[model samples]
Target: MCSHTCAPSTLLQRDSISKCSLCLCTWLNPRRWLNLQEYQSKKLMQDSGVAVQRFYVAHTASEALEAAKRLKAKEIVLKAQILAGGRGKGVFDSGLKGGVHLIKDPAVVGELAKKMLGFNLTTKQTPKEGVKVKTVMVAEALDISRETYFAILMDRACNGPVMVGSPQGGMDIEEVAASNPELIFKEVIDIFKGVQDDQALRMAANLGFKGPLQRQAADQIKRLYDLFLKVDATQVEVNPFGETPEGQVVCFDAKINFDDNAEFRQKSVFAMDDMSESDPTEMEAAKWDLKYIGMDGNIACFVNGAGLAMATCDIIDLHGGKPANFLDLGGGVKERQVYEAFKLLTADPKVEAILVNIFGGIVNCAIIANGITKACRELELKVPLVVRLEGTNVHEAKRILTESGLPITAAEDLDDAAKKAVAAIRK
Candidate 1:
């Protein structure tokens, strides 16, 4: 299906077949079908004849500034092209106001762009690479009567996808949910059954949606759901979905997250991946087929299973310490995997100490300890390694670690190991 050198006819046939298969799977998760990039979402909006901001894409900082200079509006948004949320929360604000830069002077745009692009934004969910300023979008800022949230997501409660609307929008939707839950309204849709016009009317009515603006919101919601089904989108959110002074309902900003499995049929969807926003270590881990993620703790943790790896991190937190990274050595892991995991952990500057917790259920502790010993020798790890070995070959594991003469503290239990790791980090 990837037509680098294939015949044109064969490529077209394969592409068509792939599209059909993906469309069939849209029902698999109607709400969470197509995961689109910001650029793609903008493109989709343009295709739908929505009134959106005029924008330009610049791959470099200079180009972004140039685009800003050309725009009629002095305001520009230099977005790092990664698909992550809370970009305006100052992951790399670079003194940009509300994620929108008032380009009063074009001279500062390039400097801001260069600094924000390729920076690191650590969110609670993931540490994303600041979207490289491949393209800066320069647009007119709008004055809004109100900001609201509009999203169509798979509703587990309804056993189908649903459109959720809130009069209260912006970055603080979570706060709104916590403080006032009644303000939010939801409408579930059975994609196969299709959405009824009356249902849209009622939803609009319940939300106190009135006047021309209300009708527009209702229509936009309907159209958004249609796009969701058509594109097989996973999550589509327009936060602070605006009611501008001109009676136009505009999605001032969009955040979309997609399912990778659907990439087979959604060729355009897959093209949305922006590598500029991904961490180098994570990218490298993906390349090596490893499940690894960086964290903000001082203790670099390496465990055998995903569940156990998480438990280890929790225990570390329970003991009043943070985990530097989550590195799962995996079940039935070998010396090579262990060695690579260790290398990845030490590579992180945030990691001040290392914790090797091996349950050795399906994986023998001795193998893990041997890997640790091997990894230490090869990498000459300067950080302290606090290891807890149990289950299979526990004694052998301890012997290997102790004999290595590396800066390793071996514990017989989780509690003791966690304490030691915390103590080591504090020291």
Candidate 2:
């Protein structure tokens, strides 16, 4: 079902796939994964021997000016370091036209940096409020002769890693994939053997590099793959992996995503995460080892499993209600965690009603019931609450809720729960 080419892996059975499959799925769907800023990604690339323009990171106007002067280039490029894409076309809250600018004079770099730093930059990939720019990358500008696309990604279709490249670059690769599919080329890599020399050469050739330039591009591609494996990366993409007018190949811009599963072993890489760019509520949820994503709706949902959590949101929408957040408690949740979950839900001003949908497999329904009662009393919950419990010890949980003398509405099923949650909001 993956969009990329299909290939079987020795590690996986024909009937079963690995988590990397879901990784690839989320990548195609454009979900928010653990990714680094451009400066961080390019730093990894440069350390791994991938040719890139010399750059310096600046946190202040004076630092920006110093960085530009340090680059000592005739023309310097100042890029506001935000996590979002489309930054070149993005506008800052200060009325600045672009997040990226090419400075002809190094002295004026401080002025532009003043307009960028501490300002919120809204791009197509960011929310309307936008993310604040705290840092900038001042780098030497290049005279590029040809631009090309290159990427290494975990592919479900390949059952492992895949190298993707294209002659078309510096634009939305998704549009190219949709329009001119032939321009997109793919090489399924042997995971054990790694990216073969021939595989690298073929990808470089496909990107339209010729003569000595092709060899340089191939070497860069190999180094990128080494970096990918070194960091346990799920995806590494270079847009406009370009050739200079002087016949030098360099990575113009890049984005890298690391596998969340590898955080245990890749601690150093994970530590580089910029939490300021993330939602405050989501970060709070992470402290409790909970999976939560904030949404734009008014109904907050707390479910035991990811699949059921999604279903709860869908059914809420089906009943003319919108979900404010997706909070998955997973299995074996503690009573305190449940209480904390309710605290989070009630804390959201947008949440007019709360929906608790739990299927007790490894979880005990009584723990959830006790947590709910404690949360309502301790937090003095103001929002209407709807509860739908099933699986283990369901009767004991229902009895506890009934004896609590709370204003909680008990539902017979998920459908009833969603309807009640929506009706509670309307009232």
Candidate 3:
């Protein structure tokens, strides 16, 4: 039940050596990864003239029942509006039952919605505790005859855009691609020309489409391509792009992912999903253009660059210290950003100690030093923090920290920093 599908690009490093097998990706900025819900994806596709099943969203059981009654269909599918997959077969920790249900009678919609609403459902794709389903969607049942997988994404191997599709859909396409590699069809698009009509026809023919539907299917691909670039989408997926008995094609499911860096242009699509509803720390990091993801460890490791962050985490684990979080301050660091990162670390009770690993390229160590002093006095962080500074005014940075009269321990290198931070938490 894969929803958002995109292979992150591998990060390249200059003159770095470590035994730790850590994979880093600076291309797909972690802070910018935006995943739209199923209903939301459908709406975006519908706007592009793609046919989709009619549905209505309900935030309460009464609303759900009312929405179903309005549909007046003989059968309906009630889907939980959570940002996770495998909902149809997922189980809730509270034993609330299924995330998706099909009811023959409209009366059953209220009964099922009662059990699903306000319940946190743990799916194979969600967190261990699962996401809460505050709303549910009731859609009219469709007579889908054929299910096919269709997607356009950036191929890391090709280093360009590629459209992938297969007649096999509604199953793990990855597994299918692995077991039956020949079954999958790929069309590498020309950067200047975009996805050509011939390529779309090939994709349609590969998906078993024939007659006038082939032309319709090709037009669908063209429209999807236009939408993809227009919205700055990294990946556009329509799994089980269904073919009806009437020789018409409709998207049974849709998924669209946009690059966070280009979010300024795609504000409308992003505004569809509220930023306030996102994780507080993640949203806060976005405000400062920092990349952050929390973990369940005591040693909070802060560093510059994505590759360095991964390396820091590896070194911390090597030194028997688990990282509390991965926080990367992008190039050209400012004192305010440094203070903000430290302030965030202080707010986390799980953070027993802090490790500041800064590689000042365009980032001046002097500003970092000032930020540390300001953050220390303002937050009054009682926990031990190990600081490691390298490149661009390193000596000046050390002098500022040494004379600041703080209890912070200074490390010579990454290994030294990890050892000191681990020692602080152990005590």
Number of the top lDDT candidate? 2
Pairs that collide in candidate 2 are none
- Model 3 per-residue lDDT tens digits across residues 19-80: 21123232224454576678888878878877788888899999999999999887899999
Taking all chains together, the TM-score of candidate 2 against the true structure is 0.90
Clashes of each: 11, 0, 0
lDDT (0 to 1) per candidate? 0.67, 0.85, 0.80
Stretches of candidate 3 off by over 4 Å are 1-28, 91-95, 127-129, 156-159
Most accurate candidate by TM-score: 2
Candidate 2 vs candidate 3: which has greater TM-score?
A: 2
What TM-score, computed on C-alpha atoms, does each candidate reach?
A: 0.69, 0.90, 0.87
In model 3, how large is the Cα lDDT of residue 259?
A: 75
Q: lDDT per residue, candidate 2, 1-427, as tens digits?
A: 2553622111121111122232243211112357578888888888899999999999999999999988899899999998787899999999998999998899999999999999999999898999899999999999998999898888875788888898998887767766787888889899999988899999999999999999999999999999999999977888889999899999998878788888999988878888788877777877776777677899999998766876798899999999998678888688888888887888888999999999999999999999999999999999999999999999999999999999999999999999999999999
Ranking, TM-score, top scorer first: 2, 3, 1
Q: Which lDDT tens digits does candidate 1 get at residues 1-427?
A: 2212211111121101221121221111111123345766877766665546677766677887787788756455556554555555545535443333555666677787776554544333344433433454555566777777777766554666767767777755656555666766777788687667777766666555678766777777777667666666655677767777778888787655455566788777677665654567766765545677666778988876666776787799999999888676666677887888888899889988888888878888888888889999999989888888888888888888888888788887888888999999898
